[model samples]
Target chain A: MRNSFYTAGFSEVMHEVKQDPREASYIYTTTACNSPHRGLSAAIGPALFGTVKSVRALGVQLADSTGGDPDGPSPMDLALTGIASCGVTTLLGGGSARELIFDGIEMLIEYGAPDGEPGQAVRCRLSVDGVTDEPLMNELVEQMQTYSPNMATMIRPVPISFDCLVGTDESTRRQLTVEAEPITDRRPAACRVRWVSGTQLVSYPNGRRMLRVDQPKQLTGVDWGPNPQEYLLMGLAADVADQLGRVAYRLTGERHLWEVSTSACEDMRGLLLKERDVVFLQGVTCRVVVPETLRAETGVEKILTAALAQSEVRDLVSRSNPGGVSLVLGREG
Target chain B: MELNGRTAIGFEEGRSSSAKWFDDLTRVRFAGPVSAHHRLLPRELSPETLAVHAGTYEDPVTGCVGTPVFQTSTFLLDDASYSAFADGAMRDVPIYTRYGNPSQWAVQEKLAALEGSRSAIVTSSGMSATASTIFALTNAGSHIISAYDVYGGTYNLLREDMPSTGREVSFVDPNDLAAVRAAVRPETQLLFFETLTNPLLKAPPIGALAEIAREANALLVVDNTFLTPVNMRPIAHGADIVVHSATKYLAGHSDLTAGAVVGRRKFLDRIWAQTLRFGGTLEPLSCFLLERGMKTLALRVERQNANATEIARFLATHDRVAAVHHPEVGGPHYADLARDDYRGFGGVVSFEVRGGDDAALAFMGRLKIPYVATSLGGVESLVSMPSNTSHSSLTSGQRASIGIRPGLVRFSVGIENVRDLIDDLNDALNGE
Candidate 1:
């Protein structure tokens, strides 16, 4: 019963990880969080805000600053949650070597209330299934506390530097909304598309500027736009360019993103596909161009590579689809 | 040093990114009200607003204004998660798509508000919903009571399919409250009927049937496909479960096929379990379509209802039309029975042509506007002959028994101009 946890989700992953070592690990990042905007701090004024990466997310203390009114989870509470989460994750990871099967794990963490600095003392009560030997369990818990990323952050405090996006004089923010007409028939995959910027997919048949889809030259299409594979490459390039532009803005004080172009070629012979097998792109190449002064700057190539590396879309598409694909063709009623 | 052969996270000093274009999150249009889920009283809003606003929440992760399709299988989990899930503390994170998705939940929330129920689940198709609901509530040798006239798909499920599954069923005339009451057995698990009967378009006394179900200690499941919640809520009339082929009026367009079961949390959970096993859950794309279409549910139903009422009136008096089967125009008895839940007479109207099967075919063939299809409830008008469509599988005797005549033509009215539809029908009726 305790061993069932391993089979609950890891059966395929275990199989895949065995085949490709890359499958053994995954990179997960939360988008952004307003964690520092706690009750009292958020109540009176804007609290420390942070984005996922470089952006130090700040949020206003949304309630009474006197800590009088109750609000959501405080920064300390969130830290505890993270600590609990990291502890559980580390225990799970570290326990894998001991042939332990964790059917369930529960943790109760208590800390002293904050007066000024509060007390550094903390207590933890943990219950997990499948740990029998007391000495081995004690060692495993010790390793979890010592090696856990967030736990280590507590044990060895790392200096956090603030980079406020709004502190810049040229700080600009915009939220874009787009609306698309509902697909009338899914078989042919037709839908009206529009963005808040007034870019409308007015490409219906017989209408003005009606555009037909373009697949590979072999595949039949009107060739109005690039194929989906080409679009993918373009997307990766565009994302990397966006990141580069941001970096460039910080470097040269230039907000204008003049031009960025990308090209890619793919052999779809493998991807003309079944449910399990479909490979679209064979190789992709991205080229970035900047002003001569900025191009000649020190570590420009490194900065460009870092921006490219931060492009999540490129990273996502670089990997294989674990779930595979299913395509269905049907008729209109 | 690599643990397996993968790149280490220390490399996250550089990596990849995630961003979505407008409204392209899943295939769902983000047209729903921003915080329909947070409202304390969604019912207080008109059906027009509730349909558009209910159950939609902004995504906290992507800042997606609409629900995004979480399309994945087997959410990879570590030991704590594995242990928790294995031990039964299942969290909100999806384990697989076949079980559920955020897209499904978004629409399910709207359906609950639409049906006035506490909980709801989306299925792959209307039949899957019915099958899941029936099989969920009934065990082997359990009994079911149905009104004789129902959608053919349901008729196939109840009358023929359930028998092989060791479930006995009895189909009584929907209007005969006493007969429906008498058919109940000690083991009867549910009283199944549409909010508005298909083809014939008569409304059953749901309040009375709810009483019968209460007396027999059975559940009341109403198929609200024809008359969407824009019309009347079956749960308000004591229905334990309200089922819908979201493919119809709720999806307004014929683009998507989805089903919903809304009712008490316990009952819906049972049905959800059935859905998981049956693997008949709605996909994110379909759920997205259903969500978009439902935003216009009350509006579409209003137009279709108004259109049908006008067309039903025209058909009842036409010389070439021998009989028009609608809640209001069918007969006073039909009208009387329909009063319990008839907001509008709905879009479907069945009529008998003057000259039997040939004349029905002739009428259908002469129709210039309505498409001759076997399905109903679309933006455009659809006309089908019962002898050839719904009752095509039944023998003439069985068909006649259910009041499905050789000349019977089911007309699902559209939101077209009433004069155009009337003129088109008149031309078909007068020709040949």
Candidate 2:
């Protein structure tokens, strides 16, 4: 279809190279433990902690929660936050696209058990306001689960590649690459969850800067922000909470109050000592709670049950790794 | 009961203190690129003032009077960005340069203001804008109706590329409302036409085409590159989307190449998504240049309009000029519609030399003021013969069949002294 004349016309001898103009490849980068003041300097207050810088040079301090007391938010918190934010936003956008109107939406995340002990899984409680159409709310939940990128990343195995660049100087740079092992077990781990702590700065392709910090010395952070795990739990809660109100309303045709609580268990040995049998994150648990007014209603339990079943984040953590992470290490001299 | 407009959720009303953390998680930065930073002015003000002041991003931090170039490739992502990507609303937030940019936003705001549209999207080139709008609005197996005399690039896209992509196009005379109406297939998704066709200066009945499109449930997309918004805004005349080769009139200088699509927010969002996938996002520097160029759009187009009118009058009676084509020149072709819809005839005037292609080439070679160039709407005048340039893709027979003669020279008049331009034309036309 390059050039076809309706009538017979002279043809030119030419060779052309062409590709689909619409397809493109995007790349994201992050440098862990980079100096705080360097790059865009997104660091808050004194740069006493290790920070991570993205390719765009935006840097934020990292909180190490692997030992003793926590510092700030660890990396996992940010990941969870990403998932939650993605879920909520996806719901908002999808709702708008469908022209489904509603009111205030919020999610409450409960990481561990009420007694502050390691839980079986992460729990999230979702709540919504305004319109209550059980069917419409149900559809929205389905849409959010299907569309949310972070939720999808969690539920489906993501192909991740890690490259290690080790070097004392640019001239002495060397590279190492590693492929992640396949998971043979989908069952929950027998061991309890051991939290890993660290602070990090992540820059997205779209100029977004995020810094994760934890509580004071009690938790290991200076209270710059929520800890990494908090962010993750918060994200899961937000994701499930995004449409629960609508789901409840759609199911019962009456506005119902509810929230999402989520938790996750991890085995410290697998994360710290390279134990093949221990899963770093054993199981993620999620529960939905309704207000006292709706506790007696049979539909309340139905809606709550439906929400947990439909929770994208729960599916992400409960399932075995669906994708592989490949790591490549390189060093600069 | 109503939190914003709808009833507030009971649990969120007594939100826990930790709920504050969700602020960063659920915030949405911009509604979309164009309207997020738009500065409003009295619509009663002149287009010239709107061109200069509308869409100026007031820097609260530095109080910068003009839009500064946002040179970075990525913005600081937050919950808004995360949310935008989740819901197919990437156009609403600034995340990546390709997805959206503040610089692009500033220019888009200005363009939307000038076109009297609710939103606009800037692209790397005019063709990209056109292509994105077409591909986004219409699905595969859709049909399009356009003029036979549309710009050569557009003609090639429809004739050569569209069918292969599962879309069909029908070429017809835009003035023949009956033929245009008759050409609408049940699957016709759009009607594309130039407000002023290239070289020939043929004007389409936009209002009538819009009505036809309405009846057929099709969109009317007008390429308003030549007339621009200063002379005429096709959207006001019922065009659903108005596209421009900012490389030409909108940018007002040959220094940069850019494009714009202006219409409703819903349509612009879809077009923005298509443009993102097409990889035709305008760079920040180019966006800045375009914004700067458009500030003087009203002024530049006014001067070009006056000068082109004078040039057409001079050429109409000249001995070497066999025929002249301009909306203002006496002819029944689209005169009523032009007078009714256009505030001013555009800056381009197409005329035929007494001889054919060679004489026109010789006359162009004799010209001193205007450059021998392919594009129009620059501040500097440009002269090109259709046979040698824009319509070269068409065989002579095909060109003639479309009423483009051998000696048809398109004169894109610039802001030059009309008397000096007349003398230059006189000297060139003498060809002694």
Candidate 3:
């Protein structure tokens, strides 16, 4: 079902997270249907036409191609249809309590990457037939895309806004995060961390120091430390700086003092007390201030390449897919 | 109040003495106390008020209190919409991020309103804003006139890039009106000048330039980055278009970088078409930051202006400071021009150290509060040497010709407490 911020059931569903009596299976269901004579072998354009009894009445599936189907619907077209269909069904299902009507919802869905950027991005221009309350609808759409089971693994297509209003505290925390990059690999390579209530205890294998993390000052907490993103970016920058220094120094064999200033771009609007798929780092610009003689040296490119190659933080920052996420609350401090 | 008894003034039809106050009402605009009715028109509102509330809009989709950032690189267009757009039938829907999007449109709407223009386009950087305008406005064999003291990036573009593209540009002294007029040839297509030239703070007589542009049938373009719309709306002064490095005062928070081109829709549409080809589109995130930054533009500019003015006065009398380059101290003619054209002197205060480049760098390092960075127009103060930063592209002779000494420090005063900033300067300069 399509959930929207404005719809009546949106707030009801987004907030209502009651644990159901369901299986806690770490492994999701994996099975395959028997299809011997009816394999999806020949794909015509975006449409897939299979043999008799391939999958009963739903035997035909259209895959996307350059210029195959003139009249047939492409796979993406069907996907968009399914998404919209599910949304409409949900709205209809929640129509009674939500004071919503299901006359019909019109959605203009567009998807493409003109810049050849990663992922098939979607922009849906949705129009609900009857909704006077706009603020409620906006909030409903945000919640709908976030909490809906249908959108659980959709990578959250909702756009976000971020205010670049980092104060001294945030700046300091970001600095300290970058300072913690040295405990990677070698002796103190595999670090361990345990969560406690709103706090976290991180320890290294051979390092003398122990690290603690706390919630932001805005939240109800002691507010003892930097948030997760602060640590992530800090570590990444530190790693890059360390590797860059080593590479540059080694290449030149003469080390004059230099300064490296970096700025990371990110959007925090999606994190308005809720979670959505947000790109943490849009890009990073590093300006290095070296001595006049070496300022325009060709070693800069080589140094950057070596730095990118040697850092674990660089690897982590570059990857779109974090290995996974899990949550187990109510821990001891 | 006495009245003439012999004249047919009070008792005559349609000419009562009571209606004499109506003349005052007609002549006296925004003279008395302000009310709700007074704020209904743009003239009634103050420049500060315009910055706070002008160009704001409610989002149609979500009814968002602020503008929405459309992050997608491409918008979905049906076959009909695609064909329609292809055939030059312009639609409001965003087709491609490079071509145009809601994020850019949102910011552009605010900029156009602020600059007194029909439309505006924000770019990836100030140079792109400039290059795009120059390219779209002029082609091979076209002649352009500009100030020699223009921003270094612009100078470099004019000298290095435009030649390869077959455009001819002349760099002249914008302060000399006669020289400027003489330089404008029959082939001249554009007359460009900074609203307030950088580093030196030379105030250009924009209305005079507009007259010249008109006489020569040329378009006048002004870079209003230094004196933002809050100080002077170039469009109101008859300039054809206004450009800005939004990274400066408009963004206000040095965290983001952006540029803008604001003008009539006729020229703006041409620039937009070329912008798509240039692919200098600003993404959704930076656009959002800039829009948010502009929310406090009036508030920030007011404080910065006040602080910089105070600092400039302080520096002028200081024994350690060699020279102070600010509009107030930049000769009577320039000061008078500035006063006439701008509501406030900008936040930038350039000065020469007692010693040369070394002393400048040392002083920058000694400062405790202000950052020794290349950027400007943030809430926190910034100090940089133009020789090593903004104007480094120019040769020593070229820079010297424009009055950018090795000792010159372009100090961009922030919205900090003036007292604290002065103390910081005192300590840094004197080792106090």
Candidate 4:
């Protein structure tokens, strides 16, 4: 396989496949290898960008679709996405180790929306099939639930805020600006702004007069490991990068510029559709900003091709298994 | 306008104004008020004053109003025959601090008086008090009956550790009297329960359990860590022995940890024997701090109890909260039991979050004021998930069977302003 891999050409081997978001579909398979395997294993179509893949061999899928915003997650949105991914990943790992093959799998997640929000409120769902033995199926479901990364993050929310400074560089005097803003704005970066007393030279966005205090301070980085969702994302990104690097290196002669970004989405169609318990992934989309030259040489039509082949998340997401949701209500009137 | 109880000289008021009469009359004054006379006044003083003033004797040398912390290890013999007193000839003699100290006795006497216990024994920690009481009450091969949902440490001690020592425990639901009665065996020597079970917040029927214990010829030990005597006096509810994890509401400030076993002299003497043998006595400094803490126990608990009640109400109304397991709002039996056994609903409330473990964890993470930590009854609110933190050792099946759910949260309401606590909870629950 190593010798044959060098001869494979990008255009000659496979054509770039276009994914349609309207059609909801998934692939399922199980293979047992003796310690090592050559082929990268799975694929998640482009339509499901932020969808979560739950459980490995018995591919379980989770639906989530809040992808465009760069701001912090809304209410339980991040938590829902985290659990979906975590559950999918854990199940896949556990099932593959146990040789629990699946014909199909699915997951549906739904959460109450913020009051008076327009459009479809957030709901997430995934489905999978083709596995025998109800006991094993239940065990896989329970395991996924127990280890769901997104679920863990949802349970343990973290305090996250950022500050943005708007100023240009100068040799002697660079006018620095600070803006204290809500964390919910979907921005990639923000600056913290505050005013110093007894000085009237500068003013902050919040109307506080900013004065020359001391040198500008960098914003503190958030401690993200304690959150299950962030940790799971970190795990997924690292795992994909590791596997892709090996395959990419084997396919090509040298290491190249490769960046992997994963976004999880939950279906909010129920809120929009006025239906109960209806949810599915908007998509699980990973944007791999690989060099165009590497893509042309390695016959990698889609950057996610190698990622899907080796990513456990991809395997779990492609299965789309079925699971149950239990809700409890308060007793007080 | 007449002073009904007054004696008056009528007509002579205007005519008897004479300088000679007034000058000849001698004025008699009574001597200073006697100390004994103050003690004779019937319930004239408040308990706040009584705790600090009653039974207190000013230092003979320094005349300090506050009791001093006596740190000496030994006391001097007043006479040459002190050795005779040590040889068991003299009855009331303190040779060593380990045996007893005046400072320890002062606090002990004060607590005993306040709790209305015939005798009291203070120990190093709440667990020590419980362990000592249990050890003193039960022997090898003796069987003990206890509530199923108890403090994790106590549960382990009774379930695993006690059995290793040839003692067996039969954990029964205190709410089920029949189950409790059925679990009792010929060797059963003692019955143990918390007035309110930790985390679970189940208020057991102390009086009913006590009656059962009395009939069975077993000593009843109640851990009154949650509902302090200010809110619920276990002894008053027929409990034979009352134990407190003074680390909770008793300390109020969360600075010191101590324990006490309050009961009849016979039982307490047995505990004292165990204490001396095992040496789990509380330090003088801890005892002093505990004494100081007791001064505000009533006030602190009143505020905490009110705060918890309000928080429970808030949680009960929350959409994210599935069920509030607080005894105050549970089954009729719990309400009746709480009413009969406790003067007020305690400060600990357990509730289940809607989305199971995931939602529970998220809520805990989002809390701004209440800390996500273990242990309860502090001045600051605390929240914990029993499944993952305290009772994580138990199997999932075991946890579920005992009603500890994946989303269950045990809250220890502190003395923070109730509005602040409610607002924090509202934000967390509403996902604001």
A161-245 per-residue lDDT for model 4 (tens digits): 1111112212222221212222222211111111111110111111211111111000000111112233233334333544445
Residue-level lDDT for A314 in candidate 4: 36
Please state the error at residue B156 of candidate 4 in Å. 1.0
Query: How would the docking of model 1 be graded?
Result: incorrect
Per-residue C-alpha lDDT of model 3 across residues B1-432, encoded as one tens digit per residue: 221221111111211112111111111101111111111225335666655554443454466677666678876665433432422322233566786665676677667767766568899988889988987776454578999989888988888997787567888989888999999764577888999888888888999899998777678999999989888999889899899999999999888879999986546755666677798889988988888888788889889889999999999988889989888766643644747668787899999988899998999989998998977778889999999988988889988888888789989999989999999999888956
Q: Give candidate 2's TM-score.
A: 0.56
| Candidate order, DockQ descending | 1, 2, 3, 4
Q: What's model 4's overall lDDT?
A: 0.51
**Per-candidate local distance difference test:** 0.55, 0.60, 0.55, 0.51
Best by TM-score: 2
- How well is each residue in A200-294 modelled by candidate 2, as lDDT tens digits? 12312112233433322111122335433334444444434434554665676655444444444323222112233432333433334444444
TM-score of each: 0.53, 0.56, 0.51, 0.49
Please state the error at residue B195 of candidate 2 in Å: 0.4
Which candidate number has the best lDDT? Answer: 2
| Residue A5, model 1, lDDT | 23
lDDT of 1 by residue, B1-432 (tens): 212211111112111112011111111111121122322235557778878877764565477666566565545554433433432223223445675555776787778877776568889999999999987776554578887778889998888788787678999987888899889875576789888887777778888889888877678899988888888898999888999888888888888888888886546655776788898978888888888888888877888989988898999889999988877665854646646465776688889998899989988999999999877778899998888877788889988888787799999988788899999999989993
Model 1, span A1-333: residue lDDT tens: 133222212222223333444432221111111111222221110100010001111121212212323442222333333344445544653454244555455444433313212232234555665456666667667655554443443343222211111112224222212122221121111112111000111112111122222221112111233333333333344444455555655666654332233433322211111111212222234444443444445545555555555543333334321211111112111
Candidate 2 segments exceeding 4 Å error = A1-333, B1-38
Candidates ranked by TM-score? 2, 1, 3, 4
For the second chain of model 1, what is the TM-score against the true structure's chain B? Answer: 0.87
Q: What is the DockQ of candidate 1?
A: 0.01
